[model samples]
Target: MKTFKVVVTDWEFENLQYEEAVLQDKRIELVKAQCRTEEEMIKVCRDADALINQYAPISKKVIDALENCKVITRYGVGVNTIDLEAAAYKGICVANVPDYCMDEVADHALALLLSWTRKVTLANAYIKEDKWDFKVTRPIYRLRGRTLGLVGFGKIPQSLAEKVKPLGLEVIAYDPYCPKETADEFGVLLVSLEALCEQADIISVHTPLTEGTKGMISKAQFDVMKEEALIINTSRGPVIDEEALIEALQNKKIAGAALDVVEEEPIRSDHPFLEMENVILTPHAAWYSEEAEKEMRSKAAMGVADVLLHQQYPKYLVNKEVKETTRLNESLDQERYALLTK
Candidate 1:
């Protein structure tokens, strides 16, 4: 029996103990490589049957070289780093683990919201500096009876709404894809984007980063928000313009912002947002939990197995077109194709 070759980028391979169980299945061979540069990624993915990438840029140049690759699986939910159009053009199936850390992210967003509203970080800094009168510099607010606006009412936002409902928050959500009935099910009022901005006491983003969503919140949007409202972003960083957010915070246009992600990963040390008292920043850890990591790794490995064994389709396919192309190709057996199509 010929073994199928699977190449995983170094980042995903790191701390992935579940690969051992996968390697035990003799039909598949897992090869790990750390591709720091585009050239290295192209070279490593050249002959791979399936590639599992994490934070590696699969540009057009790299995808063009993968003639043997039938599928590309991301270890996490976000695919902003990968070029989806290029992958689609090459007929490569792109899969991601979209449901793994939904609750973790919602919890993290709530944590940030509470921390910012209560000035937890600021209070800690004040004590370290021997300033007992921190209350004079930074005041705290109660979470009860506040209007919480969710920019996108996806799974994370839905979970967040449920969690905060007990705290007496009036949740309003804006998501064109979600139905008004669904929002009503969660006791959340569905509102327009502009209305959400103007009426919300706290606004949190939970949408994906796509052409329509990129820079959706900019200077003009911020200008309409209430000066007392706080902003929280656990979603894609670029969805909200970082420059506009910084200016808003600097000029006291809004109360504060708690960001788990920024326009740039590993934000520069000299970034102006880092120096502001009204801004709270975290290093993209909103989706991180030990249990979530285990689930993500297990689900990602299963997705790879499903593709290679020509079994069922992945639960979360980034490119739906690839499934159609794969079905037409006759490379997968009739039974497998039938199962997928059905």
Candidate 2:
């Protein structure tokens, strides 16, 4: 039997048994590491046949140092942490678990939206302070007859729209990539980014971070929003300009902001958002659930296993150009030929 070694880089999860079980029958040996730097990763993953990475920077330097590494599978959807161009240049297949956390993130965005809209946390804080007056937190709006604008119409936003439909919300979205027909099918109005900014009562951002989308929501967009409008972001933090968000919040250009992610992680103690009563912040944990976590870990490892043992490409391949040209595919071809001759 042909054997392969799989290395997992920098996972914070408490368990690896799920990943182990998925690759148990594939004659694969699993090794785990808490690599936080390129040097550390290069040292431990030099001889690896494949890698499953979570939040570790897999740079070109790390990819170039791989002696025989074939695939690098990310534990989540966004591959910004992994150097896709470097991996592709080195003929290493890059894969990710794309659909694993759609529900979790959507649910998280909804929870944040509700928390801000209903002033749940604010009420709790007031009660803790021995203030028992509903008048302190005024202007709690009813959910019905509100316009919910989604910045991106990807899976998570789509799921969120579906989940919140029962709340009697009028959902509209601005996604240049999504067809108007698709929005119509879901009973969502397709609008321009400017229109979404100006018209939405609640704006929820779900776009991925890319050059074109980074800082897409800045001072200009905030200027157009309603004075009492609420904004929620479960997507990457950099998609919204943190500085502009701060300015808008301070100026009351918007009613409140809720975020599961920020432009910078583990926000500093001095961060302004921490002091704002109208703002709600959570650790970047929008894409989390016990089931989703397990699926992400297992599916990432399975992608490596599929490449190494089954000679098949991962369904969620990030670098599609590497399918035939990758060194991993070449190695698989060689293995298939050897087995056939035997």
Candidate 3:
């Protein structure tokens, strides 16, 4: 038997070749399972020295049952699915591949924004339906000189800002932690969340789901936005309130929205967004591309190898506090494990 055991709790890829290749040490045995629940996670993960997680719930219960897990490396950047507090209590270092999909997600957000502003999809639908007229998408406004407000001025949004500025869009951001120098360099004005909502012609969300960020953009923000304003989200779904968004669209509170994520994964068939002609929806696919998939897999697997093999920290730690002795929620008091690692 191998001296150290690593398990892939779950994955979306067709095969684990990248993981296997990364964890090729003779003493490390890599296992794979489709664990869809806490019970399943506890069953196979108890014996694992490390885990390569993808969407599996590594909740408090599962963490309690983990006998030997030293690390849990996620395939994507978000660690909301895992209980960071619970894992920290058990000395498990939770890691994520934070930088792998920056380009893909930024590009996707830009695509959604451009598609909405240009009315590309609406025009295509009109022509394909044999209507053959521009009046259907009338009142489309010029993109130049319009303001684009980014909710979080993180790496992805920064990339997006760079891409949009060349097209004559002004970028303003609302990130309390963003350095003034960075904003000045990018020619972006850092404003309050409320101010951004009221001032932007187009609002794009790039925040992670946390206590503070969940439902951050709701009725109040919607109430303040211009009637022709559009919002786009490529970040976590719950960051924007689903019910409020539906109502906003129904009431024409905002001109439109383009979402790559929703409050619920695989939104129900009877979802109201489906009926709204102004909304553009995509299946939480902002972080995808053939190259991105492989890079994410390789980096995540290597994170596990770093812990179980090299006895080092994963380069991108979601919960870095695990490295120091626990102080009973002192660090988590305000942040509350929500801020995705920068």
Best by TM-score: 3
Better of 1 and 2 by lDDT: 2
Higher-scoring candidate on TM-score, 1 or 3: 3
Off by over 4 Å in 2: 327-342
lDDT of 2 by residue, 146-210 (tens): 99999999888999999999999999999999988889888999999999999999999999888
lDDT per model, in order? Answer: 0.82, 0.87, 0.87
Q: What is the lDDT of residue 281 in candidate 3?
A: 94
lDDT tens per residue, model 3, 82-160 = 9999888788888898888999999999999989988999999888989988888877999999999999998999999
- Error in Å for residue 77 of model 1: 1.2
Residue 233, model 1, lDDT: 96
Poorly placed runs, candidate 1 (over 4 Å) = 12-14, 328-342
Cα TM-score per model: 0.92, 0.92, 0.93
